[model samples]
Target chain A: MKKILNSADTFVRDTMEGIEAAYGDRVGLLDGDFRVLVSRYPAPEGKVGIVTAGGSGHLPLFLGYVGQGMLDGCAVGEVFASPAAEKMADMIRACDRGAGVLCLYGNYNGDVFNFRMACEDVEFDDIETRQLLGRDDVASSPKDRADKRRGVAGLVYAFKIAGAAAERMMTLDEVTAVTARALDNIRTMGVALSPCIVPKVGQPTFTIEEGQIEIGMGIHGEAGIEVRPMMTADEIARLILETIEADMPLNAGDEVSVMINGLGGTPLEEQLIVYRSVHARLAERGVAVVMPHVGEFATSMEMAGLSVSVFKLDAELKELLRAPAATPFYTNANK
Target chain B: MKKILNSADTFVRDTMEGIEAAYGDRVGLLDGDFRVLVSRYPAPEGKVGIVTAGGSGHLPLFLGYVGQGMLDGCAVGEVFASPAAEKMADMIRACDRGAGVLCLYGNYNGDVFNFRMACEDVEFDDIETRQLLGRDDVASSPKDRADKRRGVAGLVYAFKIAGAAAERMMTLDEVTAVTARALDNIRTMGVALSPCIVPKVGQPTFTIEEGQIEIGMGIHGEAGIEVRPMMTADEIARLILETIEADMPLNAGDEVSVMINGLGGTPLEEQLIVYRSVHARLAERGVAVVMPHVGEFATSMEMAGLSVSVFKLDAELKELLRAPAATPFYTNANK
Candidate 1:
């Protein structure tokens, strides 16, 4: 493999150490575990603790979200491997304030099982906990089976809404409700031009022939809906938008937030090209984009692909999205 | 070539269109010119106009930095090709708000020539302008000949200082002085594990054998100091830091800002691993790291490599670095 890593065995630990060292003033490891990263910024008294956890390959995702006005902590696993329940429990314990804790993560099977176990573990200590699964990938399931879909870049929307709600001193139930609402409003679909390699595997997780593309692939090289000849930027944007709009049924005068996310290897220039197409199509449909984000929100290590996410917003959701946030990898307008 | 693009010929314009579509509220293309991007946030009367420009492919560098308290405007060229002098002149005319304009870019021949021409073009209009060339790549020159080196990620520091100085309403000469100081204090070096494919060329910029690295490689695949066997993370970190310290003659109690920038393809997980080593090594040398930024500040498409930039900071530089800035890609603590 042509990766610049010491060894697969130490990759995760080394990355965690680097994160702590680089952002020492803002983030640190949880007391007993280096895999659980917690914010150095104190959790406000009686504020709901917001925690997100998942595999390590997707940076600026779970751990990178831990900071003021965002996640309180995150449990990180090895590349593409879900963290153990113990690690999640540690994160929950460390992030918990008087108001209780809420856990948010993608809807992968391993993540679901581990987080469920962690919730039970934390509950044994009388720390009330709630869980919300983000399954916003419209291509993964039919509109009627949205719960079966997997989450992708749309998880950022959930993070924003839940973080803002917690920052507003919302109770655990209120935070959970708003987080679910954000998750429900989000829809994502991706097209992959190439596959990503897992360090431990020392090979690509999947393969694609040159000049072909995989539509609806997951962040970790999961199977997509179809593989076809490569399409132009405009064609790809239309396909993904039609699929999402079919599920969400966006209409004229609808206001929503748009995210054109790069899967590791895709450059921001290409992502912006995709965003331009998206914006044009949305305008044609008379849908107004309220807030637009174009960059690598979540990624598969060096995978050349991009995902488009649309979060239909309401007044409440728009306010939450607009709230100030500060993190090492992400900072919104927080003046 | 496996790329998510429409065609090489239209890539630059398409990307620009996408940027405008996504960030229409915060940025817009200069009137009568699509290559020059100016911020929607109006320049205050009598405030120095800060502008930076360079070839394309480095997203969030020239164009992404144009927003509040960062850059007033930027001239973008085709991938790895400098924008025409006419575009730069147009940007200068538009950004100038009666307090003159300050031009900052890397120490590249084409950039230097075009910007010089632009200054002359606007001279007829009586708009005073000052230029600062960022030549901080230590490996590109000996310590005594630092001015001969090329610029890399260190240019970002120059932008921050000049942007903040202008935001504080510094005169054209004062902003130019601080920017020059920032450029002088900055040093950078990079290693490339693999080559990146230029969209127009449809081929890798250069090639390297598997398990090998090119140390001190340029952002556009220019020749590096040496080619060596791939080393462990600690070994690589030591080599880079030692080289930088040797050039700067760093000593105990020295304070610096560190930036571990990923060349597009390197994942954040791996970047953080490198950052961990950088932090530890700097600590071992008794050098204090003031503000640490660990992410993809500058990139060469999806090149699988990284660069380290160290900026020795004074009190004035530190305050400017800490000053609030907001852009689509970056936002600093403002409150």
Candidate 2:
């Protein structure tokens, strides 16, 4: 329950100010908005300007992804809420290179609505744009079609491919094509072990029984599809992999990259335990894991569950994933 | 206190097995030790092998850092303990290139003894080796002579510069030079808000009052110098920065890379607040922050608190840092 803030309302703004202060020389804030652009006004001409925006609270996800290789800019909103339309517009305008901008974001209603609105606003300023809403959360949809599901940690992988393509000065259409490919290959599902308390609300976002878990909770504390008794690490991993496989329809001999992300409260040891179960289950099915990342890649505030994400990798996607990436949240250094 | 493990003694081995199972195609365990090497073994013949080893619990550190553009290999031991001399020797042998091998690690009695033993073993085998003991924790030493302090988060900067140099095919001596420069310029101080639990002990690593903090804590839950009542965000930032400034002898207008790393249990929002205080203080002094990262870099299980590290960037060090890096624990994508 402890926090360091003057008040809940100022948390997002103050935090953004800090981010700007830290990287101000390389990044700049749009006047009077949540938009942040990599400094120097516009990126090199002909490059597809990469922009990702979403609600705050997921550091490195919505904003921390902005830098040399990942996002060109990010529009941040208040905690768990979409940024205002004007903010998204300003962010796009700042990063636009005349080749056009690609609006990459999660598939939450508020984010979609605002980002779509911003698309119109930027178009009015004579800048062309394309919107690609990520729908990669397999747990939220049935087996036949997961594109209708929500998007969660899968955005990180998509960002990697899209960012790499954009950095190569790929056309907007090319960038979009690669991003969609990466998105289609990505599937994610998260469980909630404990609820997160919004700073403004000062209460639990959701509730679960002691020693129990919610199998398909959304990032904003939305209810899950099912509530299940507490299970062992292996059991949880099986349920998650089973659900994701059903939705994504991965078959034997598929090459995949796996991520077991902690939802804040879990320790690295415990996450590794989850990964152990996940890897064993995948091995039994003959799938080859090309890359495995075990840590807190994305997190909800103090939530204890872990989310599993699998990205079926192709030659191009594997190369992009192997491409170097550095951000505040993730480092490739041998520290 | 709940954990998913057959027993405490089995944790490290089990975890390594799981990592190999998941990433065996990309990474492999050294022939007979806990050291993990990026698959393809022995890197290029002339490529300097950057080897880092320490205790197991700090994931992404010893293991996560061993990948492309970073470490060639890492040796791991039980939780909070150094690898055995033979294991360290085996790790050096597995990773050594004709150029030489560099033994970079933390400064602790167990680590120093075992690493020295490793150096001797490697020399007996005719593989030249050098040691770069990281001692960047400023709180343990006064401003006049901080070289005696133990290493903390600052070791990350050293690793990055060294790893990047090695990736560029620098000779072992050259890599060692860059690493020494990084170590000289780097400084870190950590504060603990809560303590981690060691599985073997099945208890908290240290204790603190609900609202108190321990400044200058060692990574293994060792006691800190000051046990002050909790203060505002600004106060904590000032304390950390002042200690760093005094210890590093950094003057105004110095360009530095800063990292505010969470111990484990602290949330990102809290870390951002700490970042706010940190940036504001540095900005007031006109210090140029070249690179700023805020997140869980080097953790102590689920212990809460954060460490602040500043590395005064010089031309070569900055270039190496800007080099592309990609690992399981971090990434700095190529521009």
Candidate 3:
């Protein structure tokens, strides 16, 4: 991988420092560790503070969403590694506006364990807190245990809903309920054509033959369900949609929002090609697509592949999706 | 040079069809000639309909910025190739409201020539039109004629100012003046570690030896003024800043907005590292950064490099920069 850098170990911390310097006036870090970047002002009195924690590398994903109309604070983990429970607890305390705090993140094993423990510890401090886990990657689990799927790009949508609800001074339980609802309707599936390089390892996380693609690959380079010869755009789109439909069981008439995300190296043009095929097949299946976003919404550092995320939007989900929330990454037309 | 596709010629047109299919209900396209895309519903009646055009390949750069709070319409040329003058004239007429139309684009030679002809044709059609060029690439011209530099990512800023002013019901001339002012304040420089394959050619745009980079390279794979061995993030940041400073001459205590945009293949993590170095250098130089947008604002297919853009902000430019605008590519808090 060609890049401009000093060392892999310093990637996350240095990036966070730059983020602070650029937006520090609007945000602040925890007393010691800067990983727990938060708004300069804590949540208002009696408001539910929202804290999201996950491994770094996904920009505008966690920290980008931490701002006025979005997250109150976020705990940064190491690159694709979960932050410690103690640090997570501190972030919750710093942003807990009197009402309570909600800790939200993608459903990864290490993340799940650490954040849950942090919630309990924060509660022991007499600070009310709850955990909202996003399990939206249909490719990670079969139909019977779809809830066991990994969380992928759909976490962004959950952040939006939860962040907006919290910004409106919603109660902790309400924020959790809204975010859970958002996750319930969100389903994502990803394929990797190339592997991303871990800074420490200084090598690829996964590998494939020149023209091969692995569908249902995890972000941390976890093994995918199957490997197949590279397929046409139409074939790949069909494979992703078929898996998502079987896992989530979306009906023929369901209306959904589509996200055609690039895994870094795949150009936007290629993503749009996949989007065209996906849209055609969805139309053939009599599904209605609303508010589709075709771009690099979430990426895997220089990996060449694409993911398709479908969010089955109801009145509430659609309204939340349309609501204006400002994050460095995501934006909406309605405020 | 790896891509999954049948051919390159059909790429952009097919992608446009898909973009329309996703958002086409609200978007309209010119029937066959220019491939110009415009907004649907209540086309502006008495306002200056802003028309911007350029080659394809820069996903959100020239076209993605078109929508309600942004451009009225866009005419897309072939991939990395400028559109014909007659085609631009046709699109300008389709988008022209009774007030007049404004032609906005980069300052590349081909773009300048075609856009000038389009402007003349529109004037002959008894419709008033003005041309505003974005010449922000500092490395393209000598210090004395930085105004002749090719437009890079700074075009986004010009588009923002023009779109906001037009939305506020400004006259065509007023919009032109503000856009020119914003463009004048903007300066950009880029580096290239590798090159992207032109779809038809199926080869890299340029070749670089291992462990080497081209500083001040153009977005379309044009050669840089300085060719140096690959350096650390600090060294690269310094090279880019020095080039921009030498060209635009930003002084200490100047307030500017920074955009660290990845060319294509560079990861967001690496981009942030570059940002870290850039922030430190700017702070050391006593410059106050107003807004720092760090991501892929403009890209060259799958090249591994980034560009730094600094737009010196006045009160009006800052207000416009902060104003709410929503397009496929960008969105602010209020949108």
Q: Pick the DockQ winner.
A: 1
Worst 10 residues of 3 chain B by lDDT: B326-335
DockQ of predicted candidate 1: 0.64
Runs off by more than 4 Å, candidate 3 = A40-42, A168-170, B4-7, B32-34, B41-44, B144-148
Per-residue lDDT over A1-335 for candidate 2, one digit per residue giving the tens place of the 0 to 100 score:
44445468888877777766665655667764544545333458888888988887776577767765678888877788887888788888888888888889888889898988999988788998988878877777775665567878888888878878887888999999999989888888888777766779877855788757888887777777898777767778888898888767777888899988887767776787778888888878888777677777677766677789999998988888877655544433322
lDDT of 3 by residue, A1-335 (tens): 56778777788888777777766776767784767888764457987888888888666567777876678888878778888888888888888878898888888888889888888888777998888788888878886886687788888778877877877777888888988888888888988888877777777766788778888888777778999888777788888898888766777788888888887888887887888888988888888888787776666778888889988878877777776665555566521
For TM-score, candidate 1 versus 2, the one ahead is 1
Docking quality tier of candidate 1? Answer: medium
Which candidate has the top score in TM-score?
Answer: 1
| Preferred candidate (lDDT higher): 1 or 3 | 1
Candidates in descending TM-score order? 1, 3, 2
Best by lDDT: 1
Q: Individual DockQ of the candidates?
A: 0.64, 0.31, 0.54
TM-score of chain A of each: 0.98, 0.93, 0.93
lDDT of 3 by residue, B126-162 (tens): 8898888888888888878766678899888888888
| DockQ of predicted candidate 3 | 0.54
Model 2 earns a TM-score of: 0.86
